[model samples]
Target: MTQPSREAIQTLVTQCLQEILNQRGTELSAPLTADTPMFGTGGLLDSIGIVTMIVDVEQTIAAEFNATVSLADDRAMSQRNSPYRSISALTDYILGQLSEGA
Candidate 1:
């Protein structure tokens, strides 16, 4: 199977985040972007929100890409830069995981 492009992964991530936010009836002061912070200081999501987003992203990836990935795995946590730091970071991480599995 062909691995998904970064843009596709990014779109998926963004969709998952929006879905999660909508479910919780949360709204952001600004529009979501590649630089939008998902975790850490000034982040949009709290710990529980981040976890929920991760799980939703993972499941979406599985269904869309036919690839199963653990977004919050040890490898992700051990990275120098966190995958959960921003939308772009998470997209890159998911693309990497899909590439590896391919």
Candidate 2:
């Protein structure tokens, strides 16, 4: 499969976040969007929550794109600006990884 577009990836991430929120019984005051913070202060997710989101996103990408990629692997952990900082950053990271597969 071809690399998914940024918007497509963002949509997937948003869906994943919503699923996580439902599973965790957490309620969001607003809709999930690209600017929604995923970690750090005022972020929606804690460390474990971030990990869950990474795994969820990875699985979804593997299933939807037919490509196995690690979202919480060493490369991502070592990044100066973490991809998990927000929906937009994660989407960009996923897009980069998918392009690498291409």
In candidate 2, what are the lDDT values of residues 1-102, reduced to their tens digit?
777778888999999988888999988898777988887778899889998999999999888889888887899999988898899999999988888878
Q: Name the top lDDT candidate.
A: 1
Q: TM-score each candidate.
A: 0.93, 0.92
Candidate 1 structure quality by residue, lDDT tens digits, 1-102: 888888889999999889888998988999999999888878888899999999999888888878899888999888888899999999888888887888
Output the worst ten-in-a-row residue range by lDDT, candidate 1: 93-102
Hey, what RMSD does candidate 1 come out at? Answer: 1.0
Error of 1 at 87 (Å): 0.5
> Number of backbone collisions per candidate, in order?
0, 0
Off by over 4 Å in 2: none
Computed on alpha carbons, the lDDT of every model, listed in order, comes to 0.89, 0.88
